[model samples]
Target: MQKSFLIVVIVAIVGGLAIHQFVPALSASIAFFAGAIIAALLFKLLPSALSQGDGEYSGPMMTLYVGNLPYRVHEGEVKELFSQYGEVCSVRLVRDRKTGRRKGFGFVEMPEASAQQAMAQLNDFVFQERTIKVREAKTQDSDSTEKNPV
Candidate 1:
């Protein structure tokens, strides 16, 4: 990981310098493109290498549906449970606004890599006589029940 980061930094500097030296007029454009390439490579490559080449996780904020949470479980407990695997960015318990009571499920957001690890380690594991379900949260719009209201 260190080696890759060093290599990327070196390439960015060398590329920037070469472009500036040979094409003074287009130096800005050349430098911008070179920097962009380096940034993308670093973002896509660094995490994977750090994880011993397991490959980096990608994409936007992911929501994980956690079921089998003890009925008395709260947001803090949820965060604490997942924090063991990775940083828990947020834990939002779905609840009724009127009564402020849980809906028996929640969404958890963590870095994709951490989320993947958590899923592998936690999914289907027995908990208080109920098998927990950990999966990528599905969007409401994708629910067929919502699209075709009875």
Candidate 2:
């Protein structure tokens, strides 16, 4: 918090000076406000930048749903692609039980932080001439309908 505040103050002062040079009529307050806004925007991006890259992040594992995959792609292929972002715990590509054919989707399990990075980069990414989507898996209710008897 302090770091961000310092950055905002410094940027605001510098920006105010620059603006005063270019436009003498503009108030210093307005110039500082503009710089402060820019600084805040940059600060928002800081977390995302640090989130990417290898680091020991202690958190629960996350499961992600991958969709719109090419039928030709295998589980290993998907795992390999996702592993680039982090350690992939597991990858399971769904298939039709009756025919044992590909269903063109899968689930990938990994650390939460890495999973976030993967989702950001992989969502809407094109692979093998097809666009793919990556998102958090929707968990089913623990109290299943069968247990309650509708």
Candidate 3:
């Protein structure tokens, strides 16, 4: 398995380089697709190939539920605020679908350690005239229960 995989990788690399050198017009597009293919193979295929147990892979990134964001707060503002603690991967400010308005809540993704630090410092922290609530985002089931509240 390992030998075949290595052979395939070598063939792909050689083919890509040959195309890049001989076909200048198509090089850019080829490079773009080649990079994407390599990334998918490494991140997606390699993990499953290596894992022998049940297919469960939890990444190190943590997503936080941010509440009480002032209606004015945007993704960049939230990212800047959270970046003080650690690297902020993404910030998503939830918006109303019908009216296209800010929903006063959002989700932020960061490394696990950074998330903990941000949550500890920012939970209930007053920002933009509102006390912001920061905590780990709940899974779908828990989120539904909270909303329905039976």
lDDT of 1 at 64: 91
Residue 43, model 1: Cα distance from true site in angstroms = 24
Q: 47-90 in candidate 1: lDDT tens per residue?
A: 55444553334455567999766667778877887889987878
RMSD of each candidate? Answer: 8.3, 15.4, 9.0
Tens digits of per-residue lDDT for model 2 on 5-124?
Answer: 666678677877887779888888887777777666765777555334435455799999999999989988999999999988889999999999899999999999999999999999
- Once superposed on the true structure, which residue ranges of model 1 sit more than 4 Å away at CA? 1-60, 127-130, 144-150
lDDT of candidate 3 vs native? 0.82
Error of 1 at 26 (Å): 47
lDDT of 3 by residue, 1-150 (tens): 454455446756766666677777786668656745764466455655544443332569899999999999879999999999988878999999999999999999998998999999999999989999999998899889989999
Per-candidate TM equals: 0.52, 0.56, 0.59
Better of 2 and 3 by TM-score: 3
Please report how far candidate 2 places residue 65 from its true position, in Å. 0.3
Cα displacement (Å) at residue 66, model 3: 0.6
Candidate 1 achieves a global lDDT of: 0.76
Instruction: Report the C-alpha displacement of residue 49, candidate 3, in angstroms.
Output: 22
Global local distance difference test of model 2 = 0.84
